[model samples]
Target: MSMNVQNCPRCGKLFVKGFAETCPACVKDIEAQYVACADYLRQNRKCDLQELHEETEVPMRQIIRFIREGRISIADSPNLTYPCEVCGNPIREHTMCDSCRQRLVRDVNQMMDEGKNNANAEKDAHHFRITDRLKDRH
Candidate 1:
């Protein structure tokens, strides 16, 4: 059997036989990560989870959990903007936050209404044509 030895730097605990360098009870690494994330956010102002993950090598799920748990705040990014959900336009504050979406919805609704009206008019015209042809034959 091979013997493994390690030392915990924080608690001065001696680990042996397939144990971690840091003791399981010590939370130094977790505290350091929190401090790093906070510092990076304070310096950068605002960043997406993906950007922060790439820059700090933090896991995306952890970052999101941190944000949801009020450990980090997501603000409007001055340097970068996310795309609108509907039109793919860059928005600073919200997703699909643009006048274009409203306009497009209005235009689509109007076109649909016009199409319905035209169909009704066509049906009426067809009825008239059939009636006239029958009268002429009679």
Candidate 2:
């Protein structure tokens, strides 16, 4: 079967869709940007996100993505930071802050507990003691 071809979101060029989102040319450009950011950070280890962007001429979003992808290590570049996706707090790793991550986990756990309770209730609904049945009729 023929592979699907789509427009490169970055440069609007048509390309056979593969793993990368952008066309090959745009992908090369993105790699160059990453190299620029990595090289700049290697020298200026204490550079924050804004300064990195300014010095490397890389976009802030791309830098943030690199951090999220673990392409850049926060430990190596201690000053680099990006906003937490949920609360917008400055975070060097992961998509959200610790508090937000904990809260999300708590919520998910609660939902799972509730779903289990609901399933138990549903199973119990199909059965009734004779006394309960007599009461229902009354």
Q: After the best TM-score superposition of candidate 1, give how far the Cα of residue 52 lies from its true spot, in angstroms.
A: 3.2
In candidate 1, which residue pairs clash? Answer: none
What are the per-model C-alpha RMSD values against the true structure?
Answer: 13.2, 2.4
Q: Residue pairs in steric clash, candidate 2? A: none
On lDDT, the candidate that comes out on top is 2
Tens-place lDDT per residue, model 1, 31-110, is: 56667777787877667655777888866555554555666656634544445667766555544666976888899999
User: Which 10 consecutive positions of candidate 2 have the poorest summed lDDT?
Assistant: 71-80
On the 0 to 100 scale, the lDDT of residue 13 in model 2 is 93
- TM-score quality measure for candidate 1: 0.39
Against the hidden reference, what TM-scores do the models get?
0.39, 0.84
Task: Report the Cα lDDT for residue 46, model 1.
Answer: 60
| Per-residue alpha-carbon lDDT of candidate 2 for residues 1-138, written as tens digits (9 for 90 to 100) | 878999998899999999999999999998999999888888899989989999988899988888888887879877778999999999877788999999999999999999999999998998877998789888
